[model samples]
Target: MSRRRRLRSRMLALVLVGSLAGLTAVGGPAIADTLSDKRAAAKKQEQENAAKREQLAASLEGLSAELGQALLDLQAMEQRMPQAQAELAEAQESLDRSQREATLVAARLQDALDQEVSIGSTIEQDTARATRIRESIGQMAREAYKGGGTATSMDIVLGAKSTEEFIEQYGLVSTALRTQTNTLDELRELQAQNANSQARLEAVRGRVQELKAEADEKVVEADAARAQAQERKDEIQQLISQQAAKKAQIEDQKAAAEAEAAAADAEAAKIAAELAAIAAQQRAAEAAAAAAAGKPQAPAGPVGGSLFANPTSINPMYVTSNYGMRLHPTLGYVRLHAGIDLRTYCGTPIYAGRAGSVQWAQYRNGFGNQVMVDHGLVNGSSLMSSYNHMTSFSVRSGQRVEQGTLLGYSGNTGTSAACHLHFEVYVNGGTQDPGPLLGR
Candidate 1:
């Protein structure tokens, strides 16, 4: 906006030069044409400034909102990070527990397998011993049958040669029968022990298989827990990285915004100084006029409470942001807002706050299309009010306007985050809060 204004001022200078040249050599018609051409150029430049100002306003508006959203997202991510960490920890613990269980089950499986193998070996040995004993008994019975077919006590008595010989044979027969009976009973006991060993081997084999399956399941559980922990860890890391990026971007944007805002502030101060000088001149001119007519000066102090009415068509006006210092959330740097932001939709009608002369209805840097009203004097002080960031104005510089006269339409035309009215009140050429001065 300022650049265009400077260019326009330069163009006006060129026109002045042309006018001087025309005065010396050219006729009145050429001077008129030169003036007309300059006016056309000025209007074109003003239009271009309006376009650029609106474009700048639109582009800059979303930054504050973006910063706000980025800050919110960062805060939410910070809050979520702990929860994700806790979930990862919980998963890690689960994996550890599962691994421990898998190890124990594997150990138990090995033990059960060893036990089954031992029982099987024992069963094989018992079967071999039983078979050897049965074979020995069969060989003995075959030998007795092949030699005499009978070794009973009756046969021994019948075959005896003498009384003493018969007695010895009878004793031999009785001892042999008793030995056979004991041998058969031992074989039967060995068979029964082999059967019990086989049963125990089968039980141990089943237990070994069961342990193997349990160990496999524990291993699977451990793997699943490990995967879950890794996933959660990755999610947390990604979230942290994204939040960091957003914060950095927001900070960079805020830095740029702060710079722009500072420029706007300086511009406002310059404008205020210029207004003060103009007011001093106007006051001197008025004093001269009044003295020439022998009239008293305007009232010395405020006779009424407030000198201005609400500069808006909206009833029950609302304030969006108060005129004061605004602080950056992370930067901790302060910037002046300089004016009260009133709630006004785009194109909302803006009315004159008090009867005054319009200083300018044009774009002024970051303020966009603005209207400054110099309400001569109030409460023995120079008073002024400005309506900023308007879509368009109905009044022009030096135009007399009455209180409640339609001035312009509110807008988001310059350095605004949204559609609203930046209303400023000045007392003795210094900015003051407009809230107390504006009518309720």
Candidate 2:
């Protein structure tokens, strides 16, 4: 009997020990819960850091593109400037050529006028001499005709003492009369020819004057054309100046944008460093906690929930899509998926993820009932987030909301296959991947 009691006591001790082990197994997870929580918080911070980094990168790229375009504009303006200068030079050359031709033509016209004046003087002198000679010949003819016809007949009928005397007297009378008539005729003809020559010379002089006037007019026209061309060049130069000023202004804007982007990049880096440090600290804490409890560290931080500070269930949960490339439900082909989709029962409550002011609330083509919130300006610019596809809204367009405040309800109001939330973050006006910021 004594031996049986000892064996029973030993069996009872074994049973007690087995029961204690079972209770410990059941309570082990609860004991290590704090470690899990710490790890999850760390991971959430890291995810936010990554999202910020992406935003910074996108801003940098856009700034770079703007700067490049500005440079091209400035270069085009520079090119136009040279062309305008060349055109101006050409216009000046044309003006100079016209002026020189006008000077030469004026000199030639003066010479022609001088020659015509000398020729006119000579013609006037010749005309006066011819008139005097004709008047003398007319007087001699009148005197000869004054002798009666009977006296001229008797002198011719009476023979001279000798034939020689008669012949000489007759020859003398005839020669004198013929010479006077011929002299008068030659003077008249010379007078007529001199008048004609003077007329022709005057006509030539008039033509020279006309040529001078025409050349002067042409010079004036060329000068006007040159002036017009110069004016055009000036206008082009003015345009180039304005364009250059505009380019400078745009360059200033680009510089400002680049500075802003750089600042954003720096801030993102700082945030990432803080997140990494926090994660390391949490990991250290978790390691200590696990050692103390003598169990494996719980898999902290849910797969998609490691990126936000306060992740909570404000609305009923459903996952419609996940990250990475997937065949688009509506686009009908493979496309890069930037974020995950959270579906819910139609009209279910949707809540704010953080404290912020409502920036905009409206309907969009694909997003339907969209709501954008401006948390605040970061690195010299606004940091905004948007939520889309809602059946109804709870908040006004510019209402402020704290974390977990009701924002709207889920719906298929947009280009959606079903009722779901389409969320996005923006550094400026561009879209960014929302997966990191949506972590829980």
Off by over 4 Å in 1: 1-73, 162-171, 236-251, 260-327, 334-440
Model 2 residue runs over 4 Å out of place are 1-77, 100-104, 107-115, 142-159, 225-261, 264-440
Local lDDT at 53 for model 2: 35
Lowest summed lDDT window (length 10), candidate 2:
19-28
Residues 1-440 of candidate 1: C-alpha lDDT, one tens digit per residue: 67434433433332232111111111111111376785785566457554443333333431344554565566657655655665666576677677667656656766776788788888788788888878888998898989977576777778899999998888877787888898899889988888888888888878866765676567568668867877877787698799889878877877766666676767788888988887677677777888999996664453245667777777788766666766645446666667777777889899998898998888877787889998877656678889988998899889999999999898867666557788888776778877777653
Model 1 lDDT at residue 352: 92
Candidate 2 achieves a global lDDT of 0.56
lDDT of 2 by residue, 1-440 (tens): 67334433433332232111111111111112376875775566457554443332221221333453454445455544544554555455556565556556655665666778777887888888887887887777677678642234348549577778887877877787678778878897887889787887878788776855655565565657566565756666576677868666665675565464455345334433443454455556666888899977654332222233221243434444554565521113454444446655577777776678886677754456877776653433334566676788888877989878888887766444445565555544444455665652
Best-matching candidate per TM-score: 1
